[model samples]
Target: MAAERGRPRLARDTIVGWMVLVLFVSLLSVVIVVRESLHVSVTERANADVTQEIEEFRTFTRTGVDPETSRPFTTAERLLTVYLSRQRPGSGEVIVGYVGESGVVTTSYGAGAPDVDEYDLTRDPAVLRAAEQGTSGTLDTPAGEMRWARTVVDVRGGDDAMLLVAVFTGEGTAEADRTVRMLTLVSLGTLLLAGVISWLVAGRILRPVRQVQEAAAEITEHDLTRRITVGDDDVSGLAATFNRMLDRLEEAFRAEQRFVDDAGHELRTPITVIRGHLELMDDDPASREVTMRIVTQELDRMSRIVTDLLALAKADRPDFVRLGEEVDLPALTISLEAKVSALADRSWRLAHVAEGTARLDTQRVTQAVLQLAHNAVQHTADGDAITLSSDVVVDPDLGPALTISVADTGPGVPVAEREHIFERFAHGEPPDGRRHSGAGLGLSIVRAIAEGHGGRVDVGGTPGEGAVFTLVLPTHTPASHDHPEQT
Candidate 1:
């Protein structure tokens, strides 16, 4: 097992919770502000009407007189009756005056207002209390409630009197109460709406977190291929990051598996040969010399296989390609042609060489080309021709790329076997009576080298018409080169 890896846990869930809290506070503030404002305004309107009616009564007391006699009213009840007849308030207001219980004066409009008898001075606590205390007061009346003021009127000849004025508030209280009810209903409904909206938004925003968890739960060391689907939202970044982590995990697991597999497959033959030879050894001088030579040969083959496996394993590392300097394609191609010429007796041809300097690992590129060249030689004869060529070709979708090709005029690759030959420890079937040799790692090494350069190798052409193995490499410029994929 490898060391455990982890990332910073995203704070999306917390963010959503805080957002809902802020929404609640904002809506509550609006309800309180609007409710308080409406309450203050309505209360002031009711109090203003009460104060205005009291002022009207005071002014009349100082100026009233009898119309027919052209002199002051003869009685307090007369003055009260004259005032009530002249005054008319809004439908919501009722002005009732009490003339010391001698008579009552009431002006009524709405259905809810009371009759003159209902305004009896002795029956109303507001009137009684005001008269006793010589101050304005309020009381619950038949017309819901009234705010009343009292004044003592002194006549020149008649008995001193009492005058009371009150404004009935049945309609006003009902209206204010209705307004409050409506505001409360609106506030509740708005809060409910805000809650629903906030909940939906929060769910949508944190959907990616659920997806990440689902993907993570399903992934195992043997299977890291699952990835989360995401949209173009803020959480998309998190999804992409999660996907990258999965990719790393999968690559690491595969690399470990390959190391075990390759070690067992390549090391088995040498160890068996060494043990068998040592066990069958004799004391004879000639037999010992032959045994030592055979053992030495087997040991050398094991060393080569180990070195090749190490090279292939390192292909997955970031520093596998060290394209630190410029490589001249023409010079490298010429050098490769010179090198592979001695591997066989084939008529090797330097078909074409493009003159250009590119950012590349010269040794790895040469190694891949030399591998292809040697593979061509192994499959060909003395008179058969093998050609190595290089040229920069332009592609509309891929831009400019360097094409390195090795073509052989021999029993060419079969259509179905070309892909198989490039896989690790894979070998193509020999033609007719011929036998294939080596650990079958040649083409795979070439492939690893190509991918290490952020490029790829592909085989084409027809069987018996000579196959062409091409290495299509980008110029290693950032705009042209992409991060390499697994070989």
Candidate 2:
């Protein structure tokens, strides 16, 4: 089935791709900016070098005397030759001396000098025009772009001469190219590393979601035990929430199945009894009347069973108990004692009534207490001491609480039955060895009511003495209408 859906794009890949693309663009921008900056700096430095050389030549012409001989230079050729020979140019720099219409007189080259013809300024008319104007500027030549500055020297005894200082830009441009190449290579390597790291980190972050998907796929109506292992991140928190939802769903499904099975089992017995008696009945009026009575009794029993089942089922719903009403505990106890006193002829007496007001569903609490009272009456004879009571108690976990008890001198529940006595259809040993009459749903209803009120009902006391069934309830109202967590 998953194959039919084809392969969906994974979040990890998308995250890595976006990260790499953004990083690539940023690094590319850096490389381009740095390369341009280096180019500008190199061009400025070459122009400065050409200007300085021109200034030095002008200073030499002013002095005129040769530094070696300490005598005035006699001719333009000797003066130009002397200046060219005395100066050492920078890298990619060249100095040329020209006399009169003789064009090129003598030339000097710097380190890493290009081919002699590359910087032959005489061959370029535009350069000659600019030099004639006594201005410094750039022009393209065989050695690439060159920045040049020139000055003319006039000597009293000889032909006039021109001194040109030209600095080629090839070396600086080559260095910038090399730098850009290295930067691009490093940027590519860094991008590759970023992509690899992003893939690993994204996979780790999304692992919990994948596990949740796997767990969901494994779950069904009959199976919901799979769960994702949790962590501290937001993704892990989602997995935790999903696990909690599964827990609720599993409980709901189990309760539904149990209700169906128990309802079928309990209802079948009465149905069979009614059907058998009806089938055997003859035309005799008395026999028909007896059969009809039996059928009616069985139907009533089935109705009670179904009603109890529904009550238990509704206990799981959010609105099972309407809370937020403050009720006087003492007055509630009085009302309960008066009501349960009519259930049987047992001697009903109030042991205690708790003082104070509490927020609770009074109707539900009253029903649970009365259920305990009824159970006590069922196990005892007329005039047996059946005491009803309520009081304030301190629970280790719940803090201040209210306890209501119904104690009766009857056949106490056996030790083995106490654990599951509140379970549906669970019956204790017959009281006084007499067959109990009604369907075994009363105590279960009592338990459901107690739980709905965020309380519990438990039986204690030795066998052959009497059982004390008490409901321990919280004094404060629950925070929500949803069922409280069971202790």
| TM-score per model over all chains | 0.70, 0.86
The per-model lDDT (C-alpha) reads: 0.74, 0.83
How does residue 352 of candidate 1 score in lDDT?
Answer: 94
Instruction: Return the TM-score for candidate 1, rounded to 2 decimals.
Output: 0.70
Give the RMSD in angstroms, all C-alphas superposed, for model 1.
6.4
Which tens-of-lDDT digit does each residue in 49-68 have in candidate 1?
A: 66787777778778877876
Question: Which pairs in model 2 have colliding backbones?
Answer: none
Compared with the true structure, what per-residue lDDT tens digits does model 2 show for residues 254-316?
889988998898999999999899889999999999999999989998998898788788787
- Candidate 1, number of clashes: 0
Evaluated at residue 294, the lDDT of candidate 2 is: 90
